[model samples]
Target chain A: MRATLMYGAGDVRVETVPDPVLRAPTDAIVRTMRACVCGSDLHPYRSMHPSATGRPVGHELVAVVEEVGPEVRTVRVGDLVVVPFAYADNTCAFCREGLQTSCPHGGFYGNHEVGGLQAELARIPFADGSLAVVPDVDPASASDALLHSLLALSDVYLTGYHAAHVGAVGPRTTVAVVGDGAVGLSAVLASRRMGAERIILMGRHTDRTDLGRRWGATDVVAERGGEGVERVLELTGGEGAHVVLEAVGHMPAYEQSFGIVRPGGVISRVGVPQYESAPVGFGSLFGKNARLAGGPAPVRAYQDGAIADVLAGAIDPGLVFDTVLSLDDAAEAYRLMDSRASLKVSLRP
Target chain B: MRATLMYGAGDVRVETVPDPVLRAPTDAIVRTMRACVCGSDLHPYRSMHPSATGRPVGHELVAVVEEVGPEVRTVRVGDLVVVPFAYADNTCAFCREGLQTSCPHGGFYGNHEVGGLQAELARIPFADGSLAVVPDVDPASASDALLHSLLALSDVYLTGYHAAHVGAVGPRTTVAVVGDGAVGLSAVLASRRMGAERIILMGRHTDRTDLGRRWGATDVVAERGGEGVERVLELTGGEGAHVVLEAVGHMPAYEQSFGIVRPGGVISRVGVPQYESAPVGFGSLFGKNARLAGGPAPVRAYQDGAIADVLAGAIDPGLVFDTVLSLDDAAEAYRLMDSRASLKVSLRP
Candidate 1:
C-alpha cells in the first residue's frame, strides 16, 4: 500500500508501505478513497513543528471500510465513511458533553495506532465512535463535487461549524470571520446556515473573497491590523461585530479579533494558535467582557448534522478544493498547499 | 469636609478637604454614610499598583444624597443610595447588555470626577444611573449590620454575584470559589443563591473558611497550588468542579483554576489580573476546551437584586466586616486590612 511521508522540510514523497491490520476488537481497516492536504499539515512542512520524519502525514479522509473486527458494530465492510481527525470512545463524560477532542481516551490520527489516512489502508480504533457512515447511495449517480464536499465533513467543514457555534453566531448577530482559507470560507457558509443576518469576511485575496461572497459573506475587508479593525467597525455602525470567528492563529489575527469584537461579545477561535502565550491584558478582553472559546473541534459531535446539510446541498464547501491530484503526486499536493497556491487539494487513491 | 488620602505606599491620613459641590446638572452631592477599605485598595497599599500620592482612595460607599442638581431626577436629597464603584450612564449598548463596567460614558470613581468615596461627601456624576437607592429605612430604625450589608452590596457583594453569574453556576453544578476574601465569600453566597448544589471554598484560613461555610460552601480545601489542585480533584472524584470562580487575580490563583476545572468546564475570573500575559497555550485551556470568561465586575448591573437580597435579611454579607473604625481612623483601617489582621474593615464618617 502507498503512503505519504514527510522526510524533512520541503521533502514529501509517496512510498509503498505495509498495509495496516486490525489490532483491537473495535478496530476497522479503511481503504482510502479520498485524502487531502490540511492547512495544519503545513506546520511541520514549514519546519515549525517537531519533524516526524518518515511518519504517515495526512488526517482528513473519505474512506470505505474493507474489514471490521468482531466488536465493531456500527460500521461494516463496504460502507463509505467520513473519519474525524481524532479517535474517541464517544462515551466519556467529555465526549457526552460534545468535547470529543478532549475525550479521556481520545488521540488524533497520526499520533496513535492509526497510521494516517493518506495511506491506501489505515487502521481505525473505536470504529463505531470514530466513523460516521455516509448513507447508502450509488457513487456512480453522485457528482464528483458532491462526493468531495461530503469528504470535507471529515474535518474542515465541521471545524468551521464549531467556530460559528462556539462564537454563538445566529439571527441578530453580525459576524466577522477572520482569514479566507477553506475553514474561513466554510465558516461563512456556516454562519449563514446558522441564521446570521450579516457576515463579513476579512481577507486580502480577491479570488477567495469572490467565492466567500457567493458562500454568504455580506462584505469583505481587505485591510489588515488597525486599518482592518477600522473597516470592520465601519461596516457594523462603529460598534464592531457581535460574533467574531478567528480562523487565523497568528498574533495579528488574534489582535484584530480583540479589536473588532463589541463589548460583551464572543470571539470563537478555531485557528490553532501558534503562540505560547497571548497577552490578554486588562485593556483587551477584561474591560469589554469579551469571551473567548474554541479549540481542536469536536468534529464527531457535529459530523451528522453537517453531513446532512452538505448532502442536502445547503452548502458546497468542497468548492474550496481548487486543485486535485492522484496518489503518485502526493508530494506535489503538499507543495501546492504549502505554497498557498491552492486553497485546498485532494488526492484520489 | 474630611477625606482619606494615600500620600505614600504605607502612609494614609485623614485631612480636611474642600466639601464636594455639584459642578454639572447631572451631579449629586452625597454625604458619606458608610465607606470601607476594599481588597483592591490593598493592591496599591502593597505597592503592587502605582501609588497615587495626595489622592483620595476609597471606592465602596453607602451615602445619603445631600443635594442634587436640576438634572438629577431619580435620586433626591436625603435618599440613601449604594454607589457602585464604577459610574455609568446606564444607557449605552454595553450598559444595556448588563456590562456597565464597559459602558462608554462610565469610569471608575477615583479615575473620574468623583474623587473617592472615603470622604465626608462625594460629587457623583450620572447620579440617576450610578446610584441604587436603598428602600426607605431610617438609620435610627435600621441596625448597623443592615446598613453595613447595604454598603457591601455597593462593591464586594455585587462583585461576588458577578463572579458566580459569569461562571454560570446554577442547579446541578459543582462550584469552586477560589479565594477567601470578601468577594470570594460573596461568590459562595451567590453560587448558592444561583442554585449550585455543591460548593467548594478553597482557602487556608480557618476563620475565613468558617465564614465561608456559613455563607454556603459545602466543602473547604485548605490547600494552595498543586496540593490545592489535588484536594479539589479528590473532592470532585477526579473530574473537577463544573464551574470555578476565580476571585484571586494572581498567577498561582489562575494556574490553580486551570488545574482544578474539569474538561469543558468554565472558569470565570473577576480578579483584576496583575500579570501582563497569561500562558494559555494548547497545553492549558485549548486542549481541555476549558473556557475563560470575566473581567471587571459590572457592579451596577447586579446592584438592585443583591441589595434586595441583603435587605431581605435572607443573607448577611456584612459579616465579612470583622472590624470597624471612625472617620479619624481611616488610615488604621487600611493598616488592619493590609496586615491581614482583619478580613474587612468599615469606616463611619
Candidate 2:
C-alpha cells in the first residue's frame, strides 16, 4: 500500500508501504477513503520539530473498516468510520473522564507502532473506542462534501469543538478565534454551533476571513500582535471576548490569546504548542482570572457528536478544504499547507 | 499614626507615619483592628522580591471604618470590615465579572499610592467595593478567635476559597492542597466547605499538617518532588486528584502542580507567582487538558461569604495564627513567620 512519508525538511513523498494487519483482538484494519494534511504536520515539516526518518505522515482520515479482530464487537467490516488521531482503550479513568488524549493506553498516529492516516491501509488499536461509525453510510456512495466533513471529525473539527467546549463558548458568549487556518475556521464553525452570539476571526488573509464571515464570524481583525488585540477589543466594545480560541500553536498566538481575552474569560487552545514555555505570570492570565484549557483534544470522545452534526448538515466544516488531490500529489499538499497557500488540503487514497 | 515599614531586607521597623486622609469621594479611612504577616510577606522579607524603602509591610487586615467620603455608601464609620488587599471600583466590567483584582481602577497594597494594611490606618480607595462589612459585630466585643478568623477572610481564607472556586472543587471531588502553609491549610478548609469528599494536604511540617487535619485534610503527603507526586498518585489510586490547589509561589510548586493533577483536572494557584515563565507545553499541561487557573484572589468578590462563614463558625481558618504580638514587635512577627516558627502572626495596632 502506498503512504505519504517524510524523510527530512522539504522532503515528502508517496512511497509503497507494507499493509497493516490486526495485531490485537481489539484492532481493526482501515482502508483509507480520505486523508488530509494537518496544520500540526507543518511543525515537523518546517523542522521546528524533529522528524522521524521515513515515517508515514497524516493523522486525520475518514476510512472504511476492511477487517476487525474477534474482540472488536462494536465496529464491523466495511463500515465507513472517522478515525480519531489518538487510539484509546476508552475504559481507563481518564477516558471515562472524557480525556481520551491522555488515556494511559492510548497511542497517537505516526508513532512507532501505528500506521499513519495518509495510507491505503492503517491498523487501528482499540477500534471500538477510537473509530466512530458514520452510520448507514457507504463510502462509495456518500457525497464528496459529506466525506470531507466526516474526515474533519477525525481530527480538525473535533479539535475545534474541543477548543470551543473547553473555552466554555455558549449562548451570550463572545468568541475570538486566533489563526485563519483550517483549525481556526473550524473553531468559528464550532463556536457558532455552540451558540456564541458574537464571533471574531483574527487573521490577515482576505479569502480566509471571507470564509470566516460565511461561517458565522461577526467580525474579522487583520492586525497582528498588539494591534490585533486592539482591534478585537474595539470590536468587542473594548471589553475583549469572553472565549478566545487559540488555533495557532506558537508563542505569539498564545500571547494574543492572553491579550484579547476579557477578564474572567477563558482561552482554549487545541493548537499543537510550538513553545516549550509561556510566561503566564501575575500580569498575564492569572490576575485576570482567565483560564487556559484544551490540549491535543479528546478527539475520540468528541468524534461521535461532531460526526452526527456533520451528517445532519448542522455544520459544514469541510469547506476548510480549499485544495484537493490524489494520494500521489502528497508533496504538493504539504507545500500548499506549509506556505499558507491553502487553508487545508484533502487527499483521496 | 504608627505603621510597619520594610526598610530593606531583614529590616522591619514600627515607625510613626502620617494619618490617612480621604482623597476622593470613593475613599474610606480604615483603622486597623488586626493585621498579620502573610506567607507571601517572606518573599520580600527574604529579598526574594524587591522591597521599596519605607513601604508598609502587610496586606491582610480586619479593620474598622474610621471615616468615609460622600460616595462611600455601603460602609459606615465604626463598622468592622474585611479590607481586600486590592482596591477595586466594583463598577468596572471586570469587577462586575467578579474579577475585582483585574478591575481597571484596582490597585494592590504597597504598589503605589495605596497605604498598606499593616498600619494604624489605611486609606482605602473604592471603599464600597474593597471593604466587606463584618455584620452585627463590633471589633471590641468580638472574641479573639472570631477576630483572627475574620482577619483570614481579609486574605488567606478568601484566597483559599478562590483557589477552590477556580479549581472547580465540588461535591465528591478529590482535592489536593499543595504547600501546607496557612493558605494551603485554608484551602483544605475551603475544599471541605466546597463539598470535596477527599482532601490531601502535601507538606512536611507536622504542625502545619496537624492544622491541615483539623481543617479536614483526609491525607497528608510529606514527600517532595518526584516522591511527593508518587505519594499523591498512590493516595489517589494512581489517578491523581481532581483539583490541586497550589499555594506555594515558585517553579517547583508549579511543576508539582502539573505533576499531580489528573488529566482534565485544574490547578488553581492563589500563590503570587515568582517565576517569569512556566513550561506549559504540549507534553505537560496542554496535552493533558489540565487547566491552570487562579491568581491574586479576588477577595473583594469573595470576602462577604467567607467572613460570614467564619463568623458563623462554619470554618476556623484563624487557627493558622499561631503567634500574636503588638505592632511595635513587627520585626519579630516577620521573624517568626520568616523562620517558619509561626504559620501566621497577628499584630494588634
Candidate 3:
C-alpha cells in the first residue's frame, strides 16, 4: 500500500508501505476512501513541533471496513464509516460524560499508538466506539465535497462545533472567530448554526475571509494580533465579543481571543497550544469575569448531529477543502497548505 | 469627625478630619456603627499595594444613615444599612446583568473617590444601589458577631458566595477551595449552601482547617502549589475537582486552582490578582476544557439574601472575625492583620 510519510521538516513523500492488519482484539482494518490534511499537521510540517523520523502524515478519514477483530461488534466488512480523530473505549466514565477527547483509554491516530490515515488502508483500535457507520451514502456515489465533509467529521467540523457549543453561543450572542483557517471558518458556520446573532471572522487573507463569509461570518477583521482584538471590540459596540473562538494555536491568537471577549463572555479555544507555560493575563480575566474553555474536540460525542447537519445541506463544511488531490500527491498538498495557498486539502486514496 | 487615615504605608492614625457632606446628588453620609479590617486592606497596609497619600482605609461596614442628599430615594436618614464595598448605579447594563462590580458607573469605595467606613462617618455614593436596609435585625440587640456578619456581607462573605455560585457548585459536584482566608472559609460555607456533596478546602494552618471543617469542608489539603493540586486530583479519583474557588490572589494559588480542576470544570476566582500580566497557561486550560470566572463580588446584588441567612442563624460568617478593637486601635488592627496574627479584625466606632 502507498502511504504519505515525512522524513523531516518539509520532507513529505508517498512511498510503498505494508497494509494495516488487526493487532488488538478491539481493532479493525479499514480501506481508506478519503483522507485530508489538518491544521495541526502543519505544526510538525513547519518544524515548530519536534519532527518524528519517518512519520506517517494524516489523521482525518472516511473509509470502508475491510476487516474486524473478534471484539468488534458494531462495524463489519463492507460497512462505510466516519472515523473520529481520537480513539476511545466509549465505556469510560469520561467518554460517558461526552468528553471523549480526554477518555482515559483514548489515543490519537497518526500519533502515538495508531497509524496515520493518508494511506491505502489504516488500522483503527476500539472500533466499536471510534467508528460511526454512515447510514445511506454509497462509497462510490459520495462526491469529493460530501466525502470532504465526512473526512472533516473526523476532527475539524466537530472541533469547531465543540468550540461554539462550549462557548455557549446562542441567539443573543456575538462571536469573534480568531484564525481564518479551516477550523476557524468551520467555527463561523457552527456559531451560525448555534444561532449566534453575529459572527466576526478575524483573518488576514482575502481568500480565507471570503470562504469565512460563505461559512456564515457576518463580519471580518483583516487585522491580526492586538489590533484585531481592538477592531472586534469596535465592531461589537466596545463590549467585545460575547463568545470568542480561538482556532489558531499560537500565542498571539490566544492572547487576542482572550483580550476581545467581553466581561462574563467565554473564549472557547480549539487550537492545540504548543507552549509549556504562557503567561496568562490573570488581571484581565479576573477584572472582566470572562471564561476560557476548549480542548481536543470530542468528535465522537457529536458525530450523529453534525453528520446530520452535513447530510441535510444545512451546512457545506466541504467548502473548507480548497484543494483536492490523489493520495500520491500528498507531499505537494502539504507544501501547498504550508505555503498558506490552500485552506485545506483532501486526498483520495 | 474622626477618620482612620493612612499617611503612608505602616502609618495609620485616628485623627480629626472634615465631616463628610453630600458631594453628589445620589450620595449619603453614613455614621459607621461598626467596621472591620479586610484581607485586601492588608495589601496596602503591608506595602504590597502602593499607598496613596492621606487615604482612608476601610470598606466593610454596618452603619446608620446620618444624612441623605435630596436626590436619594431608596435610603432614608437614620436607617441602619450594610454598605457594599463597591458603589454602583443599579441601572447600568453591567449591574442589570448582576455584574455590579464591573458597572460602568461603579467605583471601589476605599480605593477611589470616597472615604471608607473606618471613619466616624463616611460619604457613600450611589446610595440607592450601594446601601442595603437591615430589614429585621435590631441594631441595639445585634451582637458583635452579628455586626461582623453584616460587615462581612459588605464584601468578603458575599464575595465568597459569588465565587462558589459562579463556579456552579451543586449536588454531585466536588468543590476544591484554594485559600485559607476569610473569603475561602466563607466559600466552604457557600458551597455547602449550594449543596456540594464533597467540599475540599486547600490550606496550611490547623486553625483555618478546623474552621473550614466546621464550615462544611469535608476534606482539607494543607499542601501548597503543585503538590496541593496533586492531592486534590488524588482525592477526586484522579479526575480533578469539578469546581474550584480561588480566593487567594497570587500566581501559585491561581495556578494550583487551574491544575486541580477537571476538564470542563469551573474555577471561580474572586481573588484580585495584582499583577498586570500574570502568566496564564492557556494550553493547559485549552487541553482540559476548563473555565475561569469571577471578579469582585456583586455584593449589592446578594446582600439581602446574605443578611437573611445571617439573621436566620443558617450561617455564622462572623466567625471569621477573630479580633475586635476600638476605633482608636485602628492602626494596631491593621498591623495585626498584616502580620497574619488575625484572620479578620472588627473595629467599633
Candidate 4:
C-alpha cells in the first residue's frame, strides 16, 4: 500500500508500505477511500513539533472496511465509515460524558501506537467506537466535497464545533475567531450554526479572510496583537467579543484571543500547542472573569450532529477544501498545506 | 471618624479620617456597624501587593445607611445593609447578564475611588446595587457567628459561591477547594450548598482544616502543589476533581487548582491576583479540556438566597470568624489577619 511519510522538516514522500491488519480484538482494517492534509500535520512538517522518523502522516479518513476483528460487532467488511482522530472505547466514563478526546483508554491514532490514514489502507482500533458508518453513502459515490466532510469529521469540523460549544456561543453572542487556518475557518461556520449574532475573524491573508467571510464572518481584523484586539473591542462597542476561538496554537494568537474577549466571556481553543508550556495571563483572565476551554475535539461525541448538518446542506463545511489530489500526490498536498497555499487539501486513495 | 489605614507594608494605624458623604448620584453614605479583615487585605499589608501611602483597610462591612443621593432608589437612610465589595449599577448590560462584578460602571470598593469600610462611614457608589437590605434581622440581635455570614456575604462567601457556581459544581460532583482561607473555607460550604458530594479542602493550618470540616469539607489535603493535587486525584480514584475553587491568588495556588481538575471539569478562581501579571498554563488547560471561570463575586446577584440560607440555618457561613475586636483595635486585627493568627477578624464599631 502507498502511504505518505515524513523523513524530516519539509520532507514528505509517498512510498509503498506494508498493508495494515487487525492487531487487536477491537481493531479493524479499512481500505482508505479518502484522506486530507490537516493543519496539525503542518506543525511537525514545519519542525515546530518534534519530527517522527519514517512515520505515517495523516489521521483523517473515510474508508471501506477490509477486515474486522471478532470483537468489532458494529462494523463489517465493505462498509463505508468515517474514523475519528482519536480511538476510544466509548464505554469509559469520560467517553460516556462526551469527553471522548480525553477517554482513559483512548489514544491518538497517528502519534501513538496505531498507524495514521494517509495511505491506501489503514488499521483502526476500538473500531466499534471510533468508526462511524455512512448510512447510505457509497464509498465510490461520495463526492470529493462530501469526502472532505468525512475528513473534517475526523478532527477539524468537530473541533470548530467544540470550540464554539465550549465557549457557549449562541444567539446574541459575538464570536471572534483567532486563526485563519482550516479549523479557524470551520469555527466561523460553527459559530454561525451556533447562532452567533456577530462573527469576527482575525487573520492576515486575503484568501483565508474571504473564506472566513463566506463561512459567516461578519467582520475581519487583519492586524495582530493589541491592535487586532482593539478592533474587535471597538466592533463590540468596547466590551470585546463575547466568545473567542483560539485556533492558532501560539503565544501571540492565544494572547490575542484573550485580549479581544469581554470580561466574563469565554475563549475556546482547538489549536494544537507547539510548545510544552506557554504563559497565560492569569491576572487578566481572573480580572475579566473569563473562561478558557479546549483540547482535542470530541469528534466521536459530535459525529452524529455534524454529519446530520452536513447531510442537510444547512452548512457547507467542505468549502474549506481548496484543493483535491490523488493519494499518489499526497506529498504535493502536504507541501501545499504546509506552504499555506491551501486552506485544506483533500486526497483520493 | 475612626478608620484603619495602611501607611505602608507592615504599618497599620487606627486614626481619625474625614467622614464619607454621598459622592455620586447613585452613592450612599453608610455608618458601619461591623467590618472585618479580609485575606485580600493581607496582600497589601504583607507587601505582596503594592500598598498606597495611606489607604483605608477594609471592604467587608455590615452597616446602616446614613445618607443616600438623589438617584439611590433601592436603599435609604436608616436601613441596615450588607455592602458588597464591588459597587455596580446593576442595570448595565454586564450586570443584566448576571456579571455584576464586571459591570461597566462597577468598581471594587477598597481599591478604587470610594473610601473603604474600615472607616466609620463609607460613601458607597451605586448604592442600590451595592447594598443588600438585612430584611427582618436586627443589628442588635446579630451574633458574631452571623457577623461572619454578613462579612462573608460582603466578599468571601459570595466569592466562594460564585467560584463554585461558575465551576459548575453540582450534585454528585467532586470539588477541591484550594487555599483554606476564609474564602476557601466559605467555598467548601458553598460547594455543599451547590450539592457537590465530595469536598476536598486544601490547607496547611489545622484550625482552618477543622473549620473546613465543620463547613462540609469531606477531605483535607494539607500539602501544596503536586502533592496536594496528587492527593485530590487519589481521593477521586485517579479521575481528579470535577470542580476546583482557586481562592488563593498566587501562581502556585493557581497551578495547583489547574492540576487537580479533571478533563471537562472546571476551575473557578475568585482570588485577586497580587501581581500585575501571573503565568497560566494554556497548553495544559487546553489539552485537559478544562475550564476556568470567576472574578469578584456578584454578591448582590446572590445576596437574597445567601441571606435566606444563613437565616434559615441551611448554612452557617459565619463560623469562619475567629476573633472579635472593637473598631479601635482595627490595626491589631489587620496585623493578626496578616500574620495568619485568625482566619477572619471581626471589628465591631
Predicted complexes: DockQ each: 0.77, 0.81, 0.56, 0.53
lDDT of 2 by residue, A261-283 (tens): 98888889889999979978877
For model 3, the docking class works out as medium
Structural similarity to truth (TM-score) of each candidate: 0.97, 0.97, 0.96, 0.95
- On lDDT, the stronger of 2 and 4 is 2
Report how far off residue B68 is in candidate 4 (Å). Answer: 2.0
Candidate with best DockQ: 2
lDDT of 2 by residue, B53-159 (tens): 67877888988998999988888999998888888899987888788888888888864487777888899998998889988996789888999988898889888
Error of model 4, residue B94, in angstroms: 1.3
Worst lDDT 10-window in candidate 2 chain A? A48-57
Model 4, TM vs. native = 0.95
Query: Which prediction has more favorable TM-score, 2 or 3?
Result: 2
Residue clash pairs of candidate 1? none
Regarding lDDT, does 2 or 3 come out ahead? 2
Which segments of model 2 are wrong by more than 4 Å? A48-53, B48-53
lDDT value, residue A115 of candidate 2: 69
Q: Please tell me how candidate 2 rates in CAPRI terms.
A: high
Residues A56-84, model 1: lDDT tens digits: 77888888899999999889798888899
Against the true structure, candidate 3 has what lDDT?
A: 0.85
Clashing pairs in 4: A280-B280
* Residue ranges of candidate 1 with Cα displaced over 4 Å: A48-53, B48-53
**Mind giving the per-residue lDDT tens digits that candidate 4 earns over A285-345?**
7677887777788889988777777777787777888898998898789778877887889
The recovered share of true contacts, given per candidate in order, is 0.73, 0.87, 0.59, 0.57
DockQ, model 3, C-alpha based: 0.56
Interface DockQ of candidate 2 = 0.81
